[model samples]
Target: MAEPQDRAQEREELEEIVRSIGRPDAFVLHEVIRRTGNEELRRHGGALFLSAFAAGLSIALSLIVPGVLKRYLPAADWAEVLVRMGYAVGFLVVVLGRQQLFTENTITPVLPLLHDRTLKAAWRLARLWAIVLAGNILATAAIAAVIAHSGAFPPEIQRAFAEISHQTIAFGFWATVVKAVFAGWIIALMVWILPATGAAATFVILLMTWLVALLGLAHVVAGSVEAFYLVLTGEASLHDYLWRFFLPTLLGNVFGGVALVAALNFGQVAPEVEEKKDADGTG
Candidate 1:
């Protein structure tokens, strides 16, 4: 009993020491981005594009994963639950790799921009959007073509891919865009929450993303999987994809992630920082 109390006291002292080191200031996030914006933009711009493209390619597995599981366990109703775990694999790869993903940028970098609000900031955001979207599409097209030609994935999986392709066509333009907006918001929230979660960030990100996928939220990169499937099958033209899915989803994602989450996050923290500076000045 005495040993247990001593151990508890020691643990409390260690925790207090850790706390005395202090949590990161909210402004630190903004400052890091502000200080490193140029180098970060240059390095991450290409990286984001490549990562977004990779994400597009990887996300296609989501559609096929369930089908593959079903093919093996056709009679098992609970198998659907197991396949959902596969959806997190791509997100884990992209995020942990520290690659630039458009969905994440919608919130992360924008917080600093919103706090500062400069012309250069606007230009950076524009450049990032253009590069990421173009890269993602190119990646999706390349991957889809490879999958269609490779004969690697089973035929049933290919057929299921085709089925998902047809469903995107049915959603028309506006609805797909609208759904993508919601997905962007959720993804941005995941990014916002990640910095605070520390070691558990992976699990938090996976849970949030899985929830987004399970809820039928549309993501620009993820949706590219289905869009490319149609393109590969020669059932849908790239023109339709550009006009219907790509443009609308792109705009919607930017609006949802940047305008909503990033802006709001900055709004919440900026005033407090300003007040503290004012107090310091007065003192």
Candidate 2:
């Protein structure tokens, strides 16, 4: 049996946590921004840049795995599903490896900033976003160039890369942007849920990524692989990719991850927290 005071304190603490989770407004967004800003600052630019690069490089494995599966199961219609599962490989590696991924940053750091609404916090998030996006794009391009030129994969796999490139081109600008927004929303949610999952984080990461692939959603870093491959092969122009795919997807992702998911998450919790604070002050 618990003491009366102890039980009361426990109930209060639980209520506070629950209230925090329920709010989805500016205050909560500010909190998320501040917390993420602190985390980014603590990690520093070097680690963040390197981790983002690693995430890009590792995520390229998703492209490769699907190609390998395609080669092995060339005739099977369902093989695409199995091959697509390989898309989760890089996500698992990055998340479990504790690397900084840009999508995750979109929500994580913003929470704190939203809560505080300070100029410094806003600048921090802006800086982090710029660095992470640049690093991720560069890394993805480098890996894609290497894969295209290395001859490490068989001709069929190379052909598969071309096929993936063509498919991306077919999506056009708006579709890609819309798909990327959805993907970013899902990825942000994944990050939000991860801290609570303990050892099951990897499984959750896999499930989320697999869903992204299944839904034909676009991811900036991951999509860069296909875009670069096309550019390298002379099949698709860099101008087209940059204008049609990269820029739109980038904007959409930021909007989806930050505005739709993170902001809303903050909104939901803010009211409950305010109510609890009022109750405490009155008591």
Residue 148 C-alpha lDDT in model 2: 93
lDDT of 1 by residue, 195-269 (tens): 546678789978988876666667777667677778778888988788878788888888888777777666767
RMSD of each: 9.2, 7.2
The C-alpha lDDT values of all candidates are 0.68, 0.78
TM-scores, all candidates, are 0.78, 0.83
Candidate 2 vs. true structure, TM-score? 0.83
lDDT of 2 at 103: 83
Local distance difference test, candidate 2 = 0.78
Candidate 1 has an lDDT of: 0.68
Give a tens-digit lDDT track for model 2, residues 39-109. 56445788788988888888888788877777778677588778778889988888788776788788888
Cα lDDT for residue 220, candidate 2: 80
Model 1 root mean square deviation, Cα atoms: 9.2
